[model samples]
Target: MKNDRGNSSGSKSWGMMALFLITGAVLGGILGEFAANSSFLTGVAPYLVKQFPIFDLPPVTVNLYVIKFVLGFALYPNLMSILGIIAAIVLFRRF
Candidate 1:
């Protein structure tokens, strides 16, 4: 008899994709910075390291009688970082 369980060999969770994307973004940003600073890559610096803010959530504070909380969010992506995200997606699909 065939197995009733779904195929697990090819499936990947969203959490894994998120983790990969975040890691890719961080590494790409770092590489972009290094490229920007490296004299050998001066010509490509302008294309790689310029960050454009896509979202900004200013800090907000909530205070209760006994507790307080602060929250915020921001997204600033550069060209190389965007490329990194794409690369991550490709890698995720391949694996």
Candidate 2:
């Protein structure tokens, strides 16, 4: 086996960390939206109904809209980033 100085363990660690960060961000957004009583389905449900003229349901409440925006746009993104960085540090330390 040739000793490849070009392929350092740190590079692998960083790559793994980046992957974790991305996943964390996505999960955080989803979870935050859920916690805030937001629905990915509901958000687009009205538009679909309008376009297709099916499921004649009322518009989503303002409270839900507020919650969803807060969670999906504000809280989740920041939390995810923080969590991702922490996770990366922990994982890197282990390796």
Could you tell me the TM-score of candidate 1? 0.84
Pick out the ten consecutive residues of candidate 2 with the lowest summed lDDT.
Answer: 45-54
- The best candidate by lDDT is 1
Q: Write down the lDDT of every candidate, Cα atoms only.
A: 0.88, 0.49
Model 1 Cα lDDT, one tens digit per residue, 25-63 = 988898899899999998989889989999999999999
Off by over 4 Å in 2: 1-11, 38-76
User: RMSD per prediction, one decimal?
Assistant: 3.2, 16.2
- Alpha carbon lDDT of residue 36, candidate 1? 94
lDDT of 2 by residue, 22-89 (tens): 76656644544454454656664333222212234444434665475222222323443455456656
Model 2 TM-score is 0.36
Per-residue lDDT, model 2, residue 34, is 55
The C-alpha local distance difference test score for the whole of candidate 2 amounts to 0.49
